[model samples]
Target: GFPGNYTDHTIANAAALLGAGRVVGVHRKAELPNYKVFDEKRYFHPGSRPTVVTVKGFRVGVLICEDIWVPEPVRSARAAGAELLVVINASPYECGKQREREAIARARVTDVGLPMAYVNTVSGQDELVFDGNSFAMDATGEVCMRAPPFVEGLYRVDFVRERGRVVPRSGPVAAELSDEASVYGALVLGVRDYVTKHGFPGVVMGLSGGIDSALTLAIAVDALGPERVHAVMMPSRYTSQMSLDDAADEARQLGVKYSVLSIEDVHRDPRDAGRGVRGAPGGYHGREHPVALPDAAADGLVQQDRTDAADHRQQERDGGRLATLYGDMAGGFAPIKDCSKLLVYRLAAYRNGLGAVIPQRVIDRAPSAELRADQKDSDALPPYEVLDPILAAFIEEDLSVEEIAARGFDRATVGRVLDLVKRNEYKRRQAPPGVRVSRRAFGRDWRYPITNGYRRESR
Candidate 1:
């Protein structure tokens, strides 16, 4: 097999040693991808052409990641007398990315009349995670063999000459991952590899009693064993006793090193500070809110409001002057920042399903910031049942206000939500990067202009 190279030196040498003919797709010069989630333009040049060769009395073609997605490369190989296509990919895992790959491959196979085998790299790489849902399809555009997602292993397949053409024998087809499962797996792998690859001894995170911190802690403990993870709870005067108890219970159940630090001395009520510190228009204090938590129905909105009223106290004191790395907000990374209010709850429940690490009460309790007394998320925003879907439509689906309102929401509400999403772009831009699990995340996928004046025309 030939790989993309700068010159034919390596390929020629290897072919001479093996005494076999080979085709190589190599960069004549350094090239780079000048688009989303890729900085390749900073690295290597583009290759010459699709590699086609003869192997085991069969003509075969080899293409790289970007090559297979387009039509010309596969067509070129077919013109060169290739009967089979082998595409090597390092495609990153985004929501529904695997489907896109298969669709592209199917189109190629359909056009070229050659059986295609698409192999992708698996495991996590920093902010990106790769899903190895490798598979092969026949010239008729049907999958012949499929490998499981997110796992790494070798799969064997037999090809036989039938009717003067090489045909792939049908084999095992692993079930595609469910939406929640796939996202969760991606997050776990992303955390694990990011921590390990950087050669960190362990990870430390603030385990506030809230859903975002709770889910983050669970992911951390799952990625790196409890021994390698540390959870700390910092309570202020506004912190509720329930939050304290729940935070403590979470640390105990997960079996991680836990510590409680009181920030009451330095904590000031924003109202008292009198700096007009308004609550940021988001869920649970600018943190990822939960999606469909298990006991979400059990703890009704009535309970949520009641609990919020009980927990509400004061605005979170602005920490611009006091922010420090070693203070209340000390951590190398923030895992759940991108999660929505409802998704955070859902992930916590999902993690608990594998084991009872997060206490049931934590999942069942109403979410609060605990930065001030009786401060419920609902105080500043609509209920998550209303907010999450709206956020999804705007942030992920790119729907207009009228379109969102047509989906049974108030026009004013939709308008307000969209405004918040736009106004908060600066905040999101400054926030630390988190795992991307949606079609359009706040990270690389989104590149909106901060000062744009384009308004959604009402229908």
Candidate 2:
């Protein structure tokens, strides 16, 4: 592999300085990959050749992340008398990525007729979460050992020579996490690391009585503990009493500090108050009442930062139109912003299972922005049950409108949903960074030109 500048020269110099011997390295490929989610071509020149070396009395093959996905590299390694395969990876985490890794490793080992040990990095870098699901597979394409996913540790693997052939000795095998569990764990780890590593004192989020906010609050508490998390309820004209009660109940149960700051005065200006979000001003107007705090001072509540409507009204009167939705949207972090509406419900259920924190009604109630009178999410978009899969197909799976419609969705509805997803690319880009759990999240993985004229209808 090319190590940036001076490649083999640097390695040789370092090896000589360290008194090393017999360092074999792969040549850089002539061409690099330039595709979705990858811009490798602009980086290092590709390795033009393969290399193998003997390590600890075993002839081992070394391959980088992308090389193992193709067959020719391993074939060349085996041709060079390699008895064992060791792959070093900096693979990013995606849905079912570990399973896919194992499956690919099994295929390579079966092709090369050798035991393989795969190593991967586990770190949450920006929007990318690298799951360390390193593993080893026998020549029979069976996983003999596996390191835990989303955890960092030193794992020891024992290999014994049996009848003049090296075979991986049975070792501790970590059970695969269920899909929901794996995703939930990734979210927790991602949030925990991001908040703590960045040295944020704590986090604050608007605690609407919706599934998205409910799930986000739970994640914040779980990641940084209730003491470091704060929830604010900014109610407006359309806010429901049930929403107020539920939000307060959830805050109390989670032991996170919360406050209710009514936006009633701000909502007096129907033009700005009717719409409660960033776009389409006057499209929504909602409010929720607050409950008395158990002990705001003791909970480390910052009084000056309270979601007081008077301050917002003053700011708005001073030509600060953005202040209208600031109380509801302003936050250091947002956990469920990346999550779809349906996924929000699923995550709420998942968190409650750990311990019933989110109220059942929050999960069961119809989702509404409460921006306008009697406005529900259904008023603006298709039902999440129908919309999520369609969105996933269009965005994640890259399915065309017809392809998605062929999966039992109405063509017109799929077309509409696709249009919404495409039109919202800019909004998603502007959203706060959250955990990336899906195969293709709205963050780094879902890059599309916001001003593009391309339409799925042509396909």
TM-score of each: 0.78, 0.82
In model 1, which runs have C-alpha deviations exceeding 4 angstroms? 1-48, 268-330, 451-459
Tens-digit per-residue lDDT, 26-123, candidate 2:
43333344654567766555655565666677887767777778788888878988888877777877778898888888888888789998989887
> Can you give the lDDT of residue 161 in candidate 1?
85
**What is candidate 1's lDDT per residue for 1-459, written digit by digit as tens?**
233333433321011112145433321211234566776555555655545666677777766667766687778878988899877667888777877888988899989888988888887764578888999899898898999887889998777789998889999988777666777788787778777777766765666686667777777777788887666566656667888888898899889888775544433332234333355523232222111121122123314322110010000101011111222222344455456667767776777778877777777877665434576766667777888788888777878898899999999877776776666565454445556676666767678766767755342
* Backbone clash tally (model 1): 30
Query: Candidates' lDDT values, in order?
Result: 0.64, 0.66
Number of the predicted model whose TM-score against the real structure is largest: 2
